[model samples]
Target chain A: MNRKTLHVVFNSLFGIGGFCNAILFPIVLETQPDSLAQLLKAPVNFLRQRLWWLWPASFLLAALAKFADKKICDRWGHDAVKEMLEILREKGFPGNKEPVHFHRVTLFKHKRWWLCWRFWPWSGWLVPVVRSGHTTLNHQTCFLAPDEADHAEGIAGRCWSTKAVILIPTEDSNMTLPLLNPEVNAKPHDPHAMAEIYAKETFMDTDWVLKKLPHSRSFLGIPVVVQGQPWGVIVVDSRATKIQCAKGILASYEEIARPFIKCLERLS
Target chain B: MTTAPWIQVEPSLRMRSEPRQGLQLTLFVPPHEVPQAVRGEFDKQLKKFVIEIRYLDDEDFKRETMDDTVCLRIGKNSRRLLGIELDTANLNVAQVQFQLKEVEEEIKRAVTKFLQKDQAQEERENYALAIKAIESKGEQLLNRSILAPAL
Candidate 1:
């Protein structure tokens, strides 16, 4: 379960205990005021009464605090993802006129809990891009946002909930193409074949391009480099048919991927 | 291909580049004196580097001036383009130097700033959440305090 849900469950359980204690403590004080006076003094009855109620009240308050925290986290998490998606919408695809849809988005940590939010129209994914060597998300991830550390663990988690094809552009010389046709071990030196592999790996159906079409698919991946070392990749999925993916689009995507990458880069 | 390299002059400047083809340099000079100063520095600095120096002057400034300024151009084959402007009319030596330093520092700040910009909307929402959480807790505590009996 996600942290927000786990927190809510824990808070509810604690709230029940708190409610019982709050109700019981006052009754116990009212009934056993005289017995309690024998232990201390009748003049100190007020103190005793307060002591009896404070424990439960404090517990109840704690439960309330936890509940509020969960609510805030839920809202913030949703808004964060929404804002990112909106940016993509406004920016649109770099060069392709075809409308881009976010199929699936997720936020997950290697060892810690994972939170996945699924949207119907277009899948939006938000994942914690951890550093190259680190296995767990921690307080450092909080640096990415202002109040991310307010929680007990000091870090939030997210995951994508969609299945979409990612377009990989072939222009960037630095790009190391992912193996598309596993059957063909040989790297297709032919640009046409490479484009076909990209199309096949990305699109579920080949009907989009029946034959090996020129510039049918473009591959876009943001390199998350930390300390001059390549760490991870943030892949962009687009299905623009007319315009080919260009440098400007790549640059814009780089701008979007930067924040998450830096946050992960800073994590120890 | 035939345009002469633009040269500019300003107070207290430094230029450096490696040997390459098609490099463009645009320089901005002060009203009058700044151009001479920039030209002097460019000549000295040019000897140290393999870059071609272009001096941008009065007429170029008139034609291309977005506002009230002049720009110089210099380069070979036009591979690299650098635009330099002089704001000596409003900026002093110290201010100009500070600005140059600021630009260098901006490169570093850009790393964080770009990240912040990337998640600016998200951060704003997160801030709202944090404020709400704090406010709710505060209100609850205040209510309890008010309901409590006198000390």
Candidate 2:
């Protein structure tokens, strides 16, 4: 049967079962009283006497199930994201004209309980790096690759929270490969603008990159901080016409990145 | 159109034009050079086309020193090339020549396809505003599909 129908049937069965156990079963226990019956009846009477107890137990069981599901999902999601990273590295940053690398991965915890439980019950992730840092860290380090460094700087200034999460999108295999690369090309039509846009909206000025290039058609760069400290980054590269990085894909990546950052935090 | 120096050799390609996202183009090249007649014939048959290109290298390309290597970007999404990877280790004259020809062909075909993609016209306007929004603030709207609650 269809999903909706199945849900309706299952829920109906549960409601009926619960009602029978709560109401009818007690009545049956009261009416059928034999020596053997009282033995079976004794437990039912005890439960009936404490009718309110069933309510809390049911609620607790449902809560436990949900908690269990979340834990499982988190573990699986973490493994999946890690596997994806490995695959991207193994593929050698496909499609990009430049070479790219991943420096570090991080996970962040959502402070608001409701928000955390609703979206990320565990935590968030981020990858931070010095996009254009040379031998010694200098403000002029910003000038070498003005566009990328500027963007990286922007992220560093505002979104510098050690607790914030970074998300990456892996569903679109096409975008995933390039996003994982460290180096990218600049085409007039590249999605640097879109990446910049996403960064601006999602991260604070301290935590995102804010630069653009004329020739860069598409580019990939990772955050440069983990748990509030400056870390490395991940990168992607590609050169297909008509490519645009969507907001949805990046958000998905963030989901996985959060937990990863948490794991890193624990290790450190 | 016929008089234009650049010819439309293949069908056009189109894509969503987001400022943060860009188009990618890949081209296939022959291993060896052919006669002028062959080049002319090939151009006539398939001079333009479009393909989705993702940038993979964001760091290495930025630090690339060799002009022959064409280190275009420094992001994780960067890859070597679309169809066939050039053997950079060998550094043979013939290989370089072949790769150069391929790059040129890819660019031409990509540009033609880009122009044909009419959606870019509108997207460019939207992306411009998005850039402005980002300039005002550091964050932009991220896709919700993949977003889960932060831990």
Candidate 3:
């Protein structure tokens, strides 16, 4: 279970345990030999002798309860994301022609190089926990997959850092040599060299998203927040760049993310 | 055919696809900006490297390049510009290629600014910076590089 859920369960147990002991203290004192020392001594002896098993039992029950809640919330949270993606689909991801995928990306520390004995050394990735599209890879596997953007890399990471919506093709490339231009044949020059140069110029700087489906031109990443801290981002991608690049469209995508905040807090 | 022994001397040349020390090399951002992605890729296929640019001017930047070496400057007025340069002493010009996507984007931005309603003065200058980024870089690449006389 995540820290927030564990915190709530522990706090509840503490409150209940304290309240019960406080109320029962005076009643128990009246029944016992009437002294502060006697009151403390009686329960200690009784608990040690008769109810020793309850302490371990209570802890076992709390862990089991947390395990169950995690399953239920994970299902519920994914369903919420699926629903939001449907809404985004109907809206055509604000403005685009082809399929636009929506994914719930969360940050988690995973093991790095298990061969080395130093432990998973401070590696974190913003991975897709749940996704909306023609789902191919299992969500759980994607969690451990290397393709997930490192917290310090990719469009998802940038959104988490900037705390603002990021739209790609952020600026223009200014060089236009025939050698650099793909259309203008830099023939007599090597074909391999020509393609590499064009690709360098074409590859977008803002996105580090993996398995980027072809024709997915525009990328929109919104920071998915939980418990007042930035948790991850919801990535939305589409084929059209111009329409999806507007402010109104970006704001609309941000609105879609609001409904799922509750679900995020509960599951992860 | 019988070869002359005196003409049999082999050329000692080591060529590498120039690593893009271009805008793609910034540690804070991803490559296509820095050629680390392209750097790891060099061993995979025997492809030419993105030319590395060493700008003659540290600030604002006067830039130069040649046929064997291609140099193009990248970035906005306030941002640090990355220039492209190639090593041509070894590899035939058969392999070198220059990246142009940023140049295309700049052109698009310039056109957009030209069409916008609020741009007679400052926008005109903004439009010009975008154009000059394309023009000067293109002009540098267009003119063939002149090497100084080897004494």
Candidate 4:
């Protein structure tokens, strides 16, 4: 069968499984009486007496199941993203012509809810799908390390709690990558304007460089748009301070974005 | 609270002249951020669009909330479209609130789209303006050269 059909089937099964595990199973287990004799003893009285345990039990099971569901989805999504990155690497990072080599291609997944905490709003995280760059320093400082447990909590404390991904939803536009060199690009608040033009593409300039990784000069990112919504960003950063932007770079970024968006669409 | 069963009514079927709450926006257009003339024109255009734009569920439910008010026609022809009545009788408070949020998102999206469209429009106009300015300056320079040689 084709990839699209396979994707639809996978989604159907995932949804059904999620419903059964998170809703149906918990409710079925929790609502069942411990003893039939108790119900027989008093049908109306049984609800009043047994409901206390059943409510909490149902909630607990449902919560656990929901957590499991999110974890499963995250794992599946990470794999799909990783495969796309590998494909991008194989293609030699298209549109990326001389002096603008992709030192590293990073994907930052935006977790709308922090650890499934609905009330906490949005948080962005770099998943361990693929990485290519200077091995030690770049890996350590650029992306979130696998063992970085307190990062989310640390983000919560800062005033700049908003992730770079947040810019995508706000400003939505498209343009060629190289057209935005500092010399010719005279637009004030270029970051904000870039957010719109390359609404899909995220650019990490000086401020972001200073804050996140001083090693990387500029980062070009594109949103992985799945089903008309942005799922995450595919970022390509250069270790050099200035990089040439050209038509080939735009074409390459677009090519990478298209497949990345498609893979995420399958997950959606 | 009167528990009268609320029936969904088509917004178009309701009286257009009925007193309803209008969508109010407080835009902060910083000085020199946008030319006053452009900002003024944008404000007027945006207000017109908001009023003219149909309600969020207008297509599906035949509703038209004038000026971004979440007014719903609960009953048939002989219905009231007043704000208090809309909240108490016509609309489901919870559902309307939720729909209002969706409407807000749509409006924000619309604003972004509009700004982009407007920016493109301004760019074209600016391009034309630049050509006109250059042409006029070139003509003056030519005229000066002709006058200088004659003198």
* Tens-digit lDDT string for candidate 2 (B11-130): 111112222221321211100000000010111222311111111111122222223322222112221222111123322324212333444443344333433443443322222322
RMSD of each: 22.3, 22.7, 23.8, 20.9
- Candidate 3 chain B lowest-lDDT run of ten: B35-44
Which candidate do you rate higher for TM-score, 2 or 3?
3
Task: State which candidate has the highest TM-score.
Answer: 3
Error of 3 at B140 (Å): 58
Error of 1 at A102 (Å): 6.8
Candidate 1 vs 2: which has more lDDT: 1
Better of 2 and 4 by TM-score: 4
lDDT (10s digit) by residue, model 4, range A128-215 = 2344432322322222212233343211111012212111111122222333344444664555454443322232333443233223
Write candidate 1's Cα lDDT for A161-266 as tens digits.
Answer: 1111122333323333344333443754654566555544443223333342322223333333332223333333333321133334333434454444444433
Considering every candidate listed, which one attains the maximal lDDT?
3
Task: Sort every candidate by TM-score, greatest first.
Answer: 3, 4, 1, 2
**Which stretches of model 1 miss by more than 4 angstroms?**
A1-57, A72-74, A94-167, A172-218, A223-233, A240-246, A249-268, B1-151
Q: Candidate 4 regions off by >4 Å? A: A1-49, A93-102, A109-213, A217-219, A223-232, A238-259, A262-268, B1-151
lDDT of 3 by residue, A1-268 (tens): 7646765776676555554445443354344433448647767556545434655555565565556556653466677766765565555443434434432222222223222221232344445655665555343322221323333444455555544445444323233322322344345565455444433433322121222313344455555444334466655554443223333333344445445555656555
Worst 10 residues of 2 chain A by lDDT: A137-146
Model 4 pairs whose backbones collide? A94-A252, A95-A248, A95-A249, A173-A196, A173-A197, A174-A197, A178-A245, A200-A223, A201-A221, A202-A221
lDDT of 4 at A15: 63
